[model samples]
Target chain A: MAKENKTNINRRQFLKSTAIAAASMAAIGAGVTYIQKYKRDENNAQELLRPPGAIDEDAFLYACIKCGLCVQICPVHAIKFAGINEDLAYGTPYINAREQACDFSCDSIQCAETCPTAALYFIQFKEAGLKAIEAVQQQGPEALKNINPFEVQVVAMKKVTHIGVAKLNEKTCLAVKGKGFSGTPRGENFNGVLRPQSIKNQDGSKIRKAYPLKEQKYEREICDLCVTECPIGEEAITLKKTTNPDGSVSYKPNVLEGCTGCGVCEMICPTEPASIVIEAGKTYEEVYS
Target chain B: MSLFSKKREPLPPKKNDEMPHSKLGMPYKEWMGMNEDRHKWRNRRWAFLVFINLLFVISFALDLSLLEGSLSGSRLLGFYLLDPYNSFQLLAISIKTEYLPYLTMNFVIGFFTIVIFYSIMGGRSFCSWVCPYHFLAEWAEKLHDYLVKKKKIKEHSFQRGLRYVFWAGFILLAFFTQRLVFETLNPVGILSRAMIYGPGLILLWVLVIIAFEIVYSKRFWCRYVCPIGATWSIIGNISPVAVKFELDKCGHCRKCQDVCLVPHELWFVTRGKATNEKHYVGSDCTRCGYCVDVCPGDALNFTVKGLDKIL
Candidate 1:
């Protein structure tokens, strides 16, 4: 009888630990299932205005280690790491252009260069970089390329690929009303970066000094800051003339494919929410969805 | 010399023990009873812990916010400090990086390799020896002691049953959100970022969790909430390298029990209640060697399996 009792106790102990191990596995399985059940479908994919060289939405999620390297590398301090509240976007880097725009002040696109995983590919901005490199390599520094080999790189970067498309809300546009802006675009207290009017030196080189929007004023009869001051210049946007119902000719800004969605136009628009907004992702398709 | 490695010491063989205490070809050190080698081993482990934590904290900080070109990733020298929660989240959520030329799959391979190695080495060894949060948690416990000295408070309220509950809940949350949801609550993550970018939301969470620990519970996160701890416990259940108790040598002093982080683990392991014929032995031991260091009778020593004769 005592021998049987010893076997029984050993059997019970065996069962107890086995149950615990099985329970741990079961718990993990259930938790994974619960998450899979409620996980957002692909339709919920955020059409984020990712930093310049990011890959596809689904691929980006898997590959990004959330190391925040790109965020630290942006010269304009435009990139921000998504916080926990961003949900699936958490730990990824993004640009909230209204708050800060990637001005490409660092002409080499340093963020892409710094990405260890290459999640932000330098190739997206490569056409311009390649063109500039070729121009300098093939044509000597003294050769007059239509665009300065250096400027061509940055300006062409604003042309080839885009973060998103800029859309103008006609009803709220100041130019639609034939009204122009005067004084700082964001007003006296704004903290956004403002380029001191680009001026051509006697040597034919352009020099740009920066002043905060709160400190500078651009007075105009037609609101053309979005077109004229655009880093992409005439390539990204142009002021088109139109006649209003009152027989006054007004200029409406037409955003071309060259408008690389820098959001500088949006920031300097002088409108409260800015009439032109950059809808994130290439083309406007499926952005809202 | 490696700040992250633990030097294995051979336990003194019992008079009639079957297995050889030292593996073949190893030079055996004399087991001079209760000597400085014992104390030096414990002190070295502590110093190694501090060295590892400070080394990473500096490099992680400099590489993160200060440096131009830096060595990157959470892995170095084949050691991965990843918590299981983060690794599992990376898999379940299907996270990918945008625009990068290479695959983020490198992390996946490293994460799994570390998990397998940890399971073999006796799990939670990382937690006790290498985790930056371990020392912080210990300091928090010290603060709790100081607080209790001035007032009246119970030591710890560890409920073992609730461990898997929070563990699974975090995993489910990671899955549902398709994000590393628990990183917000991870003190290690919080501290690393705090060291780099200065104080922010995650640091605030760290302060709150540590303060919550000092006032309300002891080692509460590791005991009741860490999913990684739960995963390690499951994988490490049969690790050959574990703390073995020579029951006959024990004096019933209870010193080992007082220093153990896990509740009643020392009691059951020492009393042979957790280890009997047909039952596997380890009880979520961190292998921190605290109980081994504190044992007055030289009874508790880390050893490989086949020591069930004590039962």
Candidate 2:
């Protein structure tokens, strides 16, 4: 009878400890699940513009360690780490194009090159650059005179760099409204900077340097900042002119396949809410399909 | 309800303070002032933490490329230095082959380099000596102690074992979500990134945690949670280097326990508790050497596995 009593107590003790263990494990599992769901929901609410050469969004999240190597290497200080409220994207490098778009001033896509984890994979850009050199070399001296191999390489690199696609809101566009813009695009107090396209120095050598947007002035009969300020030039964006029924020609900025969605157009837009915006993680096909 | 309903109180004093001196005639408070005045190891540890974090800032600001990344991953003189915990999280999420190439050779080498380094030096040394967040948390702990001493707030604690649960939970979380979920809210990575890349909105979250530590709990993040520390503790288990406790030299004053960051590791420091004359401090000790500095009788000191026998 005593032995039976001892066995009963042992079983009860075992059951109690096991129940406690199971309860704690369940609580932890539930907490982690809740956090995952909350983070995913928060992340889904908005999309972020990743640095140039960033892999697919889902893979980028898994691979990036949030080391900030890309952030440190960016010469323009364009790449910034996402804040906590960014949900699953927190600590990841992103470009807030409105504050300061990636001007590609480094010409090397230095941020992507320096990425320790290849979260901003650079192989495609490298391949693009190599292919440009090969195409120029294949055409021999004739192409060499017309095309500076370096310029071709830079353009080739830019061609493959797609962080997002730029979308135009014709309803809010100053160009579509047939209004002229004078003075700075973003106003006198704006701190955003951009490197003007290749300018010749005194010795006839081209030099590119970034200048604060507030210091530069523009006089456009019809606002063309989206078209003019585009880093990828006419291939990416162009001013489309159409003849009206009244025989008057009106112009609208057209976004084309060559657009890298680098967000410079969005930054320089004079509209309250940018008339042209980068649809992050989007392709030209998806936007137009 | 029971967890929240418990009455808040300052932790009771550890042991009675009847005798100022131990049987060996070594005094407690004397060592306190002396150690504080010439705390060489503590000063060196502080300098190391400051230097490492500053290197990241300098490398970026000057374009030196000396130490080019945050604690999550970095390049030290062009050699990869990836954090093992971050690598594990990466592996957990990358079970599918589509993103398999992301785990390049550089990352694998970096990961093993850290693991090998920690296995030799003892793992938690990184927490005390290198981690930027650990440095901040240590200061916060000092402020917490002061607040508790003044009765401004009560010290609340949870089971230290909870950290292990969190460590496992994080990896499991990655497996389930196919994302490095912990990286989103990891305070260690956030603090490091903030130091190098400037402040982010998530710094507010880190501030909330520090405030909670100061007012509600004492070293809550480092003690009860922190999967990073939990990861280190596992690596620290087979470490050859550790704090060696000399049983006979112990005074039973409990000053060492009071000063220890993780006191449970010093359990055998009590009189008549230890089976051996010399016992290595447990893997969770962090090798901070606070107990060594506070020990009036010189009971605990750092030792390497076979080095002591030869010397």
Candidate 3:
């Protein structure tokens, strides 16, 4: 009986040992197959180059935690999430503002300021978008006017696009004939005026109401908000001198790049009816053809 | 067949003149043995790992300093990484201009180098001798063993399945979050942050978890949680180094299994039977050699699997 029991134990031990060896072999085989099939392919090289406007592609890619702060704070909604190919290069947090160009006139460097990581540096006023505008302005108005507003010709107009509209209420028209207020009021004279134009409201209503005297008093002289803030360069609203056939000079307003869809002009318009109101659409007109 | 024949033949009397002496001072064999003993205690492997960790910490600090401009060298390194002008020489060669390449490369290289080195020498040497995180886990396990004094809770098959399910869920979370959550749970990271950030509520909570692990479980982090360990285990299966057992010498005492921190219960499952169990050591083994020391029959031994066959 003891001999039989000992033989049974020996057989059991052999079977157990064989089973363990087989399982280990299977596990090793599986591991080998996984490594062979799933190892990272290092040959793909398309995403290596630094994207446009990135100061340092390598630094930004490594440091960016992909918090999406820049995307949230963009006032113009100019910045957009990068696509897969771009993501591979930029790692998770990357922005492309080409679709909607940046407006240099905004008061805040919202994107840079809100970036949790220093992926985008907090540039000073002179170093940020404002500097790009100043540089172009220094080159003379003719040079500025000659620029292709739609093309990101200047850095200031990085991703600008028409996002809204500016409409006026005819009832609020203070300068129309037979209105309560006509022409520029006292102390309201045009000087460094970049653009002057008839404005419309968001619903395409013409404002005909009497323009508030106090507001108009400042609007004529310092109201470069529309022209300066327009993402496009040709000054969406321009002041023009209408010459009569008899050589008489009369002042009139004109819309050049229609109105850069950005509603900055509407936001800053001072009038109650908002001489300019931004609505969703491509309001900027084609300048090239 | 006579076991006492060798002993019976040794009839020489002790001669003080015949005793070998070292000219310097101590006997050569005694001195050499003493030195070897000291080296064994010092454990050069552990020291190497600590040195690597320190190097990494120093490099990280230097990178931070570069941004402040307090250190020119660091600033230069930053510039090299973050070329603001988009006109760096290194950028020309790199496939991706993004900084992510550098970070990913660092992790991949570190992991593979250690794995390859340990696999060549013995199974999972990094875990046993060098990993800072493993050291922390081991310490915690000791504390847990001392405080809890609990018997092994035999895990049900269903409970074992739950671990894999949780692991899958965590992997999905990591994919979506784009953050290695397992890495975040690393005790090393916890300890480092606690030391640096200090006295915060979160740090306190982490400490509580550590205390709990110290009291209730043996290698709680390693057995169930550590994704790095999971990854290593998967990779280590193909490792050529392993422990072997001599079938003739094993006494079936089960002493080796008792000493093993990892539940060797599954070993039987793999082996197909309980009694015939062989030492199926591979990459999963941390090369701690605890089993080898605990084996009463002296049957267990470390061997280079593929190389021994080749020789």
iRMS of candidate 1, one decimal? 7.3
Model 1 lDDT per residue over B79-155, tens place: 33344566666555543322222534444455576667677778577677766677789889888878878886767
* DockQ each: 0.12, 0.30, 0.03
- Alpha carbon lDDT of each predicted model: 0.61, 0.78, 0.41
C-alpha lDDT of candidate 2 relative to the true structure: 0.78
- The candidate scoring highest on DockQ is 2
**TM-score of each model, in listed order:** 0.60, 0.81, 0.38
On residues A1-289, what C-alpha lDDT tens digit does candidate 1 reach at each position? 9999987887776566446644654564555334423432432433346887776655555445555556655656677766544433445678877767766666667776555454676665776667766867677655654546667677666565567777888898998778887777787777777454343557876545445667666788778878877777776788899777999787788887677777777778888877987876656443322
CA shift of A106, model 3, Å? 33
* After superposition, candidate 1 runs with Cα above 4 Å error: A1-48, A84-89, A117-119, A126-128, A131-161, A194-217, A243-247, A282-289, B1-101, B104-136, B139-187, B194-220, B223-311
lDDT of 1 at B9: 40
Comparison by lDDT, 1 against 2, better one: 2
Given candidate 2, what's the lDDT at residue B27?
58
How far residue B293's Cα lies from its native spot in candidate 2, in Å, is 2.0
lDDT of 2 by residue, A32-114 (tens): 45664576666542445889988877677677888877887787788877675554456778888888898888898988887
